[model samples]
Target: MMKMKRIALSALLSLGLTACGPMEESEPMPESMFEEQGSQALDAACTSLGTGITSHACVHSGNPADHLARTASATRVTSAPSISTKHTAYDIALPSGAEGSVTYVPATTGSYAFYRTQNVPFTVINGSTSATVPSALSQTVSSSGCLLVYVSVHDLTAGTTYIVATGPASGNAITVVPEFLDDSRTRYYRDADGDGYGSTTSIYTACTPPAGYTTQRFDCNDTVGSGASINPGATEVCGNGIDDNCDGSQC
Candidate 1:
């Protein structure tokens, strides 16, 4: 009986040793292999990005000095209009048909406008002493209370010009700012009833209008009926209780 027990114990010990041998051999995968696979994946991803990779860096592996050098070499791009020293603003007082002169020397040839703060009727002459105003480049009053007198000056040289108020004398001051093509100025009006059209009373000037406001000032009545015809273009309904056309007369 003792010999049989010893044989069973020895068999159990051999099975345990075999299991442990396989467990020891089955070690975790090497960390280097995982790192190599990750690198390959990153490379494939960057390659798949295609043309976008050219405009952007794949990885910011550059040192601080290298980053600083690249930032220093980069140039700033701006969309704002560039005005030369030749462009200027003038506050001039003029009676009706009287003229005021200012020196304007354009650095680059482009379309320019004499933007006035008030709706002052003015005719612009190329020279200060020239009696004849150019018929082609005539002055016009904009709806935004500013006179946008456009003048196309090609290969503009340094010179002075005269701005004369054409209408009867108001004895009011006018500010003239020489604006290049595509000025950012915009005029907004009050839209009390949330209608697209705005009233002529309130005037707001900015590059962009606020909410519930519009750039058009054609609303005859902002306090008209809810969802009613407050637009000036609407047909006037005669004798109706509601002012459908907002023309102050009911049909």
Candidate 2:
């Protein structure tokens, strides 16, 4: 019986089969392993984002509109700070140097993040109104001599225009990616004019509304002097030649 068992084991080994079970399939190689040898995660000159399957990267001339076009169309953009307008005064304080601006419009209202390969100062502003949009938080880390700077911005409204400025640093072209962040916080819009209603265009996200903001939106005219009465809760002062109630008609 022992001799017969040994013969059976030898037969299995000769057939390239394990005693416990048949041979298992080899695992597939990871996507990163397929990259060329010695290639850094992000190239030294520029960073490519979402560079797999359907997405691609491209160079953006220092035009804000072009930046908006490429990014909105799902193409990643690599751009350099404008030498001419780097010192242009933005809504927020910037480092003393050149900077470039990109116009971005979110597809949905939520939190979003901006990731850059180069460590440089960045800011977001309301494009239509030129108001400084505060960021929720920001961080910077090192990666193979590249600086990964990311800024988290909350309550970006869909269809509203926003501006992203990068700069005050010199080097090769830098890659910038705007990614949407998912969370459960409530969204609020700015009500600077003290109107009970807010502008749907300018939004913010938080556990509670920050100072000078409100949960209500859709104030057709939220400007000061007459905006205090222009809200959804106001009674229509019919035929006064103004849509005080924001119902799209004076009467």
Candidate 3:
């Protein structure tokens, strides 16, 4: 459907250029200040992403993680599959030049991110019937000296082989590292009292743990300031009628 629309638009543009009369000066409009500010904020966000394969930043995430790991950074170069396939509905239509497709079978089902070392358009096709558009794609980040730079996020299913299509590449070799974003997030519990221990009732999941949160859990009394002195590590006061050590009994 999308490919047909693009073809029609190209034909219309070609005809207009050939039949054009006297052309007038068309001054380009200035970019909105608000849009520029938003772009700067996005750039700042990319810089703050941590250093690792787990980071969501536009920069390369080294090699793929867990079962998805293929090889070291230098040796992961893979040949792009020819655009020709039995399923032409999911084909990527480029104005000129041949495109490529690669079969990607994820190890686990989750929100996966794909990073391309080259500055080419990348798409993930779920099956012959449907193709997924990236939910999150980098806008400000650019490639840095042969390193993977551009990135996009898509929901992938484990065991289901999908087609990863890319526009005509420079050298016909493209390295697209796919990482499971869900695996990167660690469970964190809220530590409101600033104590080393945390309450399981209040928990968070994120790659980067949020402020006032910790990995430690099982705080019997997480009641703000007073709870600071009440944790699993605290000594049990026998007659105080409180389970100071969180042992489920006071004695």
Candidate 4:
């Protein structure tokens, strides 16, 4: 993982934003490379998402050496804080910052536009239009004692390519991911048992699970029935990681 300085820019600054080190383009690894790695266990759970297979949903702040949300049509995120207009650079690449779940921010309630590198066959939506926890620590740990990740309008990254949206804040009326850059993060850590991405409160310990919650899910393959499976299935509301259908949008 590469570490760079966060040369604080304008109001558009995001807590997820970080100067990522050069990616491991070293091997020019093929899609199958993931299979050789432990990702198989991860892949066994998650698959491609709506955004397209080339997408990335979850990334780590340190060295997102592993990616999971690459399959989904869109990436998930949370609003860290109220960003000022001066720093709204919704077009920056996070070193490895992808989101599995985001804080349902009220600021995201307005009509907004999203663009991405390409378009995946999926739907983008604003779930539970309300941020549950305020601070990361204050965030009630899930059943496993992991703090819930929150999303707000401010947390949305820029320049990746995503669909556009329009409507009331939480009541998004027209959320269209017009084949753009909907590359946010979704799958980073393995949560096969839907036991919080890494660790968290019990089912209650975690934030709002997805509409169809599951457990022990991974994002390496795309054929398992788990939420992280690349193949689509009955997705459990496993804390809104963005795999609503468990098809690996975060794959």
Candidate 5:
């Protein structure tokens, strides 16, 4: 009986040991993982800009239209023939010491009038009022079978500005568009979970931020609860395993 009791005790000990298996080791996250995620998030954000628009970082000092139009000659082209016109606004980022260009492709092959307007505040070019083109603001026009308008970044201020291009009425459909010459060093933060907050370490520097990203970087846990409590001054819930205040601590 004693031997049988000892055997039963040993069996129980073995079963207990089996139940308490070895702890599984967690895999370490790769260092480049954050960077890769950030890039993907940024791509999504920029893709949302739709067609003919781009994202970049540059300085727009002020509305050049205010000064440009104010200084523009008031002599209107009275009795000018109004033709069916197509208008396009180009958003260009002109970094200091750089240049930008826009291509104007006319739908038809005929003499087309080209007009440009600077991105100015409170100025809307609805293809109604026609202002005389200023010689100072005239872009260097080039012909490669199509018209290419080039503007120097050195002449632009730091911020967002606009350039309006108007094509001739008699030609093929004219498309005015802005082109990015180079990459911008603008910083954007990754918000992989679509939370308003972004990860501090997961940062991207480009002219535009990708989808699931933002210009702001203040998220404590980008992957937690769809970015719950990721904003500044967020409440820290005790024992929830989340950094609500982005302070790297959970209550």
Candidate 6:
């Protein structure tokens, strides 16, 4: 009686992706590279991921002697932290390809391992590599040095962003996109002149947010203005900034 799953965002609305905040702290992965630290037993590059992930943790704070510098804005992160969700323009990004069969379970059997940052342990793939666990699928199984994986693959291609290692401890594993789209097919992202992140526009064009501007999230750098930069096939803009994260013109 453990059949409960519904963390549906449609694996991020079928790739018309969203969410341009959070997950942008960068530079924090050294605790002697972690073989096992104290706060828990997990590491981070990204982990503990499951239920097809969308709520995983650990970006820094891997506990490098608890180094926060103890003052002065902690160095940097002033404004742009209120991230829970928001990034539209169909979040188009497909080419983080290559993944298959990854099944590992060793809760009480000891000596279980995992691999892959980008293939080559046999051309990379764990497709159907199960270790016989059908106690009705076993709550995904994870404990102590936490680890739980299950992948059977099937068209199962959604958005993309994966890099999880577990053995000496590592992190990052975000999943979803079981199919969901709309926003003229859901995809949105914009930063224009801010350049902290989110740079990519054009989802059917028409953008203009630079005149006087009361509040600016971003506007008309090109959405279909055909200004040439939104990438893909080029030549298409009504003005929402079509550079679509190609980092050219959308502001």
Q: Report the alpha-carbon TM-score of model 1 versus the true structure.
A: 0.27
Best candidate, lDDT-wise?
3
lDDT of 1 by residue, 63-143 (tens): 222121101101112221222332344444443344433334444343344444455445544444545444223233323
Q: Judged by lDDT relative to the true structure, which candidate is superior, 3 or 6?
A: 3
Better of 4 and 5 by TM-score: 5
Model 6, 1-251: lDDT tens digits are 22323335555665554554445556444434432322121112112222212112111112233222211111112221111121211111111332222221212211111211211211111223412222111112222332222221111111221121112112222221111111101122454443322233312111122222222223334333332254433345547634554435554
Extract clashing residue pairs from model 3: none
Runs in model 4 deviating more than 4 A are 1-87, 92-110, 120-123, 127-251
lDDT of 5 at 85: 26
- Backbone clashes in model 1, listed as residue pairs: 96-169, 237-251, 238-250, 238-251, 239-250, 239-251, 240-251
Better of 1 and 2 by lDDT: 2
- Model 1 segments beyond 4 Å from truth? 1-89, 95-97, 118-121, 128-169, 182-251
Residue lDDT tens for model 4, 103-210: 212222121222222222112333334222221111111122211122222123232222222122221111111111112223233344443332111121112233
- List the candidates' TM-scores in order: 0.27, 0.34, 0.47, 0.16, 0.31, 0.16
What digit string (tens of lDDT, one per residue) describes model 5 on residues 37-90?
421112322322211112211111122221111111111222222222233333
Whole-model Cα lDDT of every candidate shown, in order: 0.41, 0.50, 0.53, 0.26, 0.36, 0.24
Clashes of each: 7, 2, 0, 115, 18, 45
> Distance (Å) between predicted and true CA of 139, model 4?
37
Residue-wise lDDT of candidate 3 within 52-77, one digit each (tens)? 43343223334233112121111111
